[model samples]
Target: MSVGLVVVSHSAKIAEGIVELAGQMAPGVRIRAAGGTDDGGLGTSFDLVMSAVVDADDGDGVVVMCDLGSAILTAETALDFLDDELRARVRIADAPIVEGAVAAAVAAEVGGALAEVVDAAEASAAASAMTSDQNSPEEAVESTSSDRRGSDLSSTTLPPSSERPEEPIGANATLINPSGLHARPAAEFVRLASTFDARITVNGVDAKSLLRIMGMGLGIGSSVRVEATGTQAQEAVDALTTLLASGFGE
Candidate 1:
């Protein structure tokens, strides 16, 4: 079974709606919603959160996402009561509830382990915050470069597709998915990209970031430039190009 997810929100409707939205992209994952007081008022419920954590766990692990401060406190309290063994496999992610749930769900759907699922949720929040403040991809690359000082900079730091040298293994394909790289399709693309061992970029954006891919705003007929570097570079490029050409089974 895949890693499960628990969404804790002050409003039951908000929690359930996030679950439904994330579930659309990850049908195989079990995502539970814990929201509102036991009396059906808008507030956190320790019992509901505890029950959801138990129900969502399927041996793999569980990742919890919260909406507000008190919701996190409720989740933490629930976790405190879990058996030690089960508690070891669960995590409460500090992330935006909706985006984090979606990213975590997709990662789990693709067989990510406990830590990877939590990382996906937190990473999505970080990526969102960074992208929101930048006006263009160049600014993003610049930020990445500045941040990498004193750290290992890899070949993936190549300039945008327009300025990069000819890659031995790269391909371009037109989006055939009627909706193009919308939320579901983009998530699928990111999920597939993450499976490879190469550093890949699609049209200059990190291939494994859901937020970055969606930010491209690529629609039907948009040309996709996929390039990769590393042992699995060729395989990564070929698979992504084929998926793009196949319309992502839309």
Candidate 2:
């Protein structure tokens, strides 16, 4: 079985809503909501957390995301009650509730291991932070070679279009779907980009990172330029550009 996810929140609606949102991108993975008290109040329930944990896990593992510090406490307490073997397979991620759950769900849906799911959840915040540097929509969403895969953040500027020469290294396509490169399409884009043996970037952000692509907020009618380098650079760029041209089959 694939890795599972559990969302812990003080409000039942919040937990359930996050599950529904994340589930859209990862229909194959099990995502359980452990929200509010057993009586349906605005308080964490250790019993509910424990039950969700058990239900979510299917031998692969479970990654739990919490909305608040106290919800984490409830999750930790619930974890303490699990058998030693199962407890060892579970992880409590220190990440945002909504973004982390979506990132983790996509990773798990793509068959990532337990640790990869946890990393994906934790990386969402950092990815979002990197995108926050943009001061305006007029700036081109681009990542320099140094900033690839979030290794550096010192530079977010791209060379002026007049100075940069067009080559076979990249291709440009327009977003045709109504939602554009939002979570669902972004996740699919990242999934396809991960298959290439090349370092790829779409509009300057890491193409293999779901949050990074989504953070750009590219919408319908927006232009998408994909660039890559390495063994499969040409193939990678072609495939991604074609996917964008297809409107992600939306």
Number of the predicted model whose lDDT against the real structure is largest: 1
- lDDT: worst 10-residue window of model 1: 150-159
What candidate 1 gets wrong by more than 4 Å, as runs, is: 136-168
Question: For candidate 1, lDDT tens digit of each residue in 50-158?
Answer: 9999999999999999999999999999999999999999999988998899889988988999999999999987888766766778887887888886366564574
Q: Write the per-residue lDDT of candidate 2 for residues 111-211, one digit (tens) a residue.
A: 89999999999999988877786654444445343347466435656678987755438889999999999978888888888888898998888898888
Off by over 4 Å in 2: 136-168
Error of 2 at 5 (Å): 0.5
Task: Give the backbone clash total of model 2.
Answer: 2
TM-scores for candidates 1 onward, in order: 0.85, 0.85
lDDT of 2 at 100: 94
Score residue 74 of candidate 2 by CA lDDT.
88
